[model samples]
Target: MRDLLPPGVHVAESFGDPPGAVLLPEEEPAVARAVDRRRREYTTVRHLARRALRCLGHGAAALPPGEDRAPRWPTGVVGALTHCDGYRAAAVADATVVASVGIDAEPHEALPEEALGGVALPEEREHLARLDAAHPEFRWDRLLFSAKESVYKAWYPVTGAWLGFEQAVLTFDPAGSFRARVLPEAVVPGGPVVFDGRWCVTRSFVTTAVVVTRPDAAPPAPCGCPAR
Candidate 1:
């Protein structure tokens, strides 16, 4: 997941349940009625989020969900979180350097046939078919879904609007990257917005991330150092 992001963006990931995970006082209400599995995932991800925040020099703090269910990050910070069966991750950056960040992870398996129509644009489906034919080892459909998830995560923070599944057209490169062309209908003031992102496939999961740097920010350092 770290490879999917750029410099100055702190990312943390956990596989399976995290030991000693507990909900902060402010975070408890959000999952008060959730099942055990839901509670564990939520708690584990927030725990990683605070750890990432501390890496940015912030104190550990509660990350309750906003009205829209997105984690309400502390002031001066921008981030995104994702959780799947056995994997959980959080990525954060100082708002001064990064405009927004989005990430997602899914099991490396084919998306259900019934969900293909809802998740992929017609042209995207055609592209996936061609890719699958050439590289049967990868699940193109699942990767497409994960990419779109990352796009939406990156979009909402900037636009403050919902981006539907069909709102973006995506194309992938076999070389570990993707491009999402946000359709004009999605309503960004500047019309269409194109997001370039990277993807990775491991033995267990397929992950994708999109990071938008602030136009006025200085270049990041060579290492994965957090922004000053």
Candidate 2:
């Protein structure tokens, strides 16, 4: 179950049926480098991620190097990381016990509706258009930008295929966690891929999303998978 941390302050979500707890550190500056915005941003998010890790009984020094480009935790761990203006956070779950998990956060921003053209599929654009129409002031583009990012981080580890923002379509339930469907014929691993997600924006400037997928359901001993 997801616990609301603060009223009108933010939102958080978890995936894949983990029985463990999720920690959402209230946002605050962690580094004293007022001179370097980038450094301060890194420090803030690192602090949030560290707190999340600690909740799992792991210390900051115990975390391993992240994946080459995807949102990956050290070997033997499954997780995702993300940060937005004034906020940095992470979500982790034992892969052996919970598959893959992803989390994302982004500050509200105005985006050209046209900018979404190349990033979102035709149907996706149509769906979001309806959303934008309903809520004329909604920052749908930024929301998609964040949601797609969360999906990429979650899917990358399993498919081992980098999904372009344009390759997948995200359909949001607007007031609820959205849905993302990989375009048919899209490149995916040669097996079952479980894709399920949820999202919420408890405040006007921030949006948070989570996607948890289980290991692909495999066939009998030997259809065609190469034995590792």
lDDT top scorer:
1
lDDT of 1 by residue, 129-185 (tens): 999999888899999999999999998998888899899999999999999998877
lDDT for each residue of candidate 2 in 1-228, tens digit (9 for 90 to 100) = 123111111222322222232222322232233465554444444444454555444434233234473433545556666655555565554455445555677667765667776677778778878999998666787778877877777677667677788867777776666767776666665622335566666555445445453446332121121100
How many collisions per candidate?
Answer: 0, 1
Q: Model 2 Cα displacement at 184 (Å)?
A: 2.9
lDDT for every model?
A: 0.88, 0.54
Error of 2 at 76 (Å): 2.7
The TM-score between candidate 1 and the true structure equals 0.95
What lDDT, from 0 to 1, does candidate 2 have? 0.54
Q: Which stretches of model 2 miss by more than 4 angstroms? A: 1-35, 62-67, 70-72, 190-194, 213-228
Against the true structure, whose TM-score is highest? 1
Residue pairs that clash (backbone atoms under 3 angstroms), model 1: none
